[model samples]
Target: MKKASLYGTGALLFLALTGCAQQSKSDAAAQLNDQSVMALNWFQQSGEYQALTYQAFTTATYAFDKAQSLTGKPKAVIVDLDETMIDNSAYSAWQVKANKPFEDKSWSRWTHAEQANAVPGAVSFAQYVDSHGGIMFYVSNRDQKDYAATLANLQRLGFPNVNAKTLRLSTTTSNKQARFDAIKNEGYNVVLYVGDNLNDFGAATYHKSNAERRNFVNSNHSLFGTQFIVLPNPLYGDWESGLAPGYNKLTPEQKLKVRADALKAWDGK
Candidate 1:
């Protein structure tokens, strides 16, 4: 690379990191409050968020209506945490601008008890599900260590009927099918499932490859606006699978090579 070009890239990188640091400082000062409601507002302001919100709402509403029509068994909705219920966009945005990989320690420090907030209409929809004899089961991959804090955050945000037991954390099982099956065995008919990731609704091993994942999504397109509700999460999820799933197995240099390979594979055809 030319000296001038390298200097420019370095300068831009510095500026980006500085901007993220400033945002983090502000977040720290604010005591990591819930911003999901505000994020929803921002989503509404964006053409993309607007369309996604509409699709998600339609799916939830349809599920609710179907639940109301059911006679004997009760209806339930399996919801994911993170981007589905809580808005961690700020964390993601910070990571992108800073050009840093996601660090759990840093992320945990940032998303203290006050950081989690409800997505737009999340609280309202959850409450509705509760009121209409629908059980809202939060099936999240978040570690069990964050359980109490997660519950506290959800409760603080007016997310109704959220209990510690209802949360199936990462401690439960590698496959979410176990969780869903547990729910089914408990007598609640799961009519709707919501998440920002594919594995949230389906089996965990569905997205090992890009082709298999796309096929899964297409095959289940019938559920797109019905039982399967997927919220938009561009910052991560299966998209990051291209970079390789397990980073611990690889050295830093190996990780970089895998990332380079992923980029190459993406651009190849």
Candidate 2:
């Protein structure tokens, strides 16, 4: 009887340990899933917006530093307002929550709709630039028709010293070179160009492959940290385009395959 009781107790202990181990694994998986959901939610919501505002602060300081170094003094820091100076989180969230993909038509409608708010630190930075006699030019890719709403949004956000004419959109020009040229023609030494997209610098030249993009950055690494401050926008950008060009071209299975292949490459086995 003693031997039987001892064996039974041992069996019970083993079962309990096994159950505990399974519970622990289940708990770990649940935690991982929760974290992933939160991360996705952040990207869909305010992550980029928050990043842009912080980048704006960095850009302001960097440009100010460059201006301080110049001989005759740098004149202006050209800024792109959409992703660079405004928080478009609500719109992003709306899209994700509604299961709507990011399409240009939808994006254009969003841009024209005037729903984006001023990014954190953007208003303060712009005000600082104005106070320091630094000209702020809004060289955005937003359509010309969006000028009115864009201006109104900026004004509503209390961005100081902004004239309606200072905001420019692509009409005749295919790229930002023309706008940069215009600034140069106006006889103001442009100290910096702040934006979240590659096109904001010079669209035609910068929107190629990953190698070309990296080369561009390498060629201008000196200016990157100081003059050309980049704001983060992981949810949408050239990077996403590089990863998955036009979702219409790829079926769900194809996308999964591409993602799997990418992971395999990372695994090196």
Candidate 3:
């Protein structure tokens, strides 16, 4: 009888320890999601965010016009789709509400819903480009499986030239340099590259750490608003993952620690 009772207690203790570990994981995930609340609030609610997008697009228009045209090639502008041309903050907000991490299935469902709204000034800028002898290429890292839905969403938002010819989705790699080269090789004079992430510009910063990204930006500071246009995207991007090596592979608890450690807090006087 004593042996049986001890076995029961051992089993209970094992279950209890397992429950505690699961609870700790759950709390860490929750904390990580909660950290995004302020970023989402600013992105979805602030006029400042809208203003920055408009400014980016407005500058892009000037750059597109100022670019000297080649004798035989058509002018082209390469722009990222998500967060640069269309706003996907609703899907991000849903993650916060559902206490879930970003999953491909959920993102695919959101894309299929065709509920993405256009970023401020994006539609107008695209229309301007289409009308002013410039072709707009929607180059995004979005999976090709979401192609039809993404095309439909862009069309519904009244973005011009969103057909299969102009909309290119990711197939294998997200580096985007090959795609950019393809456009150039097709005899189009690609002029401007626009996006919220540094990687969107080209493969120079692809998978690089934050220090390298910052160096690239600093090295090409003259290209801003001319050769490269950037929109504001604080909610999420490669910048978040650039916080640490193998950041994406880290658990939620480890991620939180990395973020906290990255802060440059001043010592109390």
Q: Which candidate number has the best TM-score?
A: 3
Better of 1 and 2 by lDDT: 1
Write the residue-wise lDDT of candidate 1 on 202-225 in tens digits: 784454666677777787778776
Error of 1 at 228 (Å): 0.3
Q: Which residue window of length 10 is worst by lDDT in model 1? A: 28-37
Which residue ranges in model 3 land beyond 4 Å of their true spot?
Answer: none
Error of 2 at 89 (Å): 2.3
**What lDDT is reached at residue 149 by model 1?**
82
Enumerate residue pairs that collide in model 2.
Answer: none
Cα lDDT of candidate 1 equals 0.72
Query: What TM-score does structure 2 among the candidates reach?
Result: 0.72
Question: What lDDT, from 0 to 1, does candidate 3 have?
Answer: 0.96
Q: lDDT score of model 2? A: 0.69
- Cα lDDT of model 2 by residue, 1-269, tens digit: 99999999999999999999878655543442333345456644666756656766866676665565345654787888866788676666656555455567877787777788776777887887778778788887777776787787788888876676588877875478888888878877787788777767776444475557777778878777577777666545565444544633664445445545544345456
Q: State every prediction's TM-score relative to the real structure.
A: 0.72, 0.72, 0.98
Off by over 4 Å in 2: 1-40, 43-52, 68-74, 244-265
